[model samples]
Target: MFDVAPTELLLVAVVALLVIGPKDLPRAMHFVGKWVGKARGVARQFRSGMDTMIREAELAEMEKQWAAENERIMREHPPAPSLSAPEAESADGADMHDLPPLMVAQPDIRPEPVAAEAPVSEVEEPKTRGQGEHPL
Candidate 1:
């Protein structure tokens, strides 16, 4: 990056105007432009703190791979044994024959009656040439 060329930057500005002399060469080029703007603001804050620690280590490795894929999909789908009414009685507990009969069908959800919309007549206004109408 130090390939200075325009005739070696005009021979380093004629040897820094003959060893910084034009009355202190504009305060030595304003102290080398304030230390090259504080070394480019500390290299842009160390490249945004190494891009925020690489996006927090890639969001903590995608939350530990989404918590190990939600614990392997809850250990391969395991959750359906609820039964309740006293576990559907049976062992000489006044028998409900280990429960398995619940039907339930009611779904007609009635709502289909909407066809009556024809009443909007009023648009006749274009008759202004009756003096032997012939403007073809």
Candidate 2:
């Protein structure tokens, strides 16, 4: 991503060594290298996790879209039983049971609660106390 060449990196390293004197130059370079490596590792791990989560989310969305599309297609072109087109009706011995497993849904049908014409309460007889029962 930096697009930095090898020559440019060497030049920068020389400048750093010159700026940081001979006594502390090696130590400073070591520390900088370690920090850079750590930063790169952390960024790589974070990007990997982000990519995995993004792919999983995309897959879930795709499945939802596919399911919606399938439902739309199923609604648009319903399975209709053909009676006069082919083998079900052309022969002299026609099979009346040859029917496709499809029919129009009853739009007027509704799930209504069934009402009973009787009361729900029932009579109960008083019970006698047991041998170990205590009276309140």
Off by over 4 Å in 1: 1-14, 17-22, 33-35, 71-73, 77-136
Q: Write down the lDDT that model 2 would get.
A: 0.87
Collision pairs in model 1: none
List, residue by residue over 24-84, the lDDT tens digit for candidate 1. Answer: 9999999999999999999999999999999999999999999999999989997788866
Q: Number of clashing pairs, model 2?
A: 0
Regions of model 2 farther than 4 Å from truth: 76-136
Q: What overall lDDT goes with each candidate model?
A: 0.89, 0.87
Q: Using Cα atoms with residue i matched to residue i, what is each candidate's TM-score against the true structure?
A: 0.36, 0.48
| Error of model 1, residue 48, in angstroms | 1.5
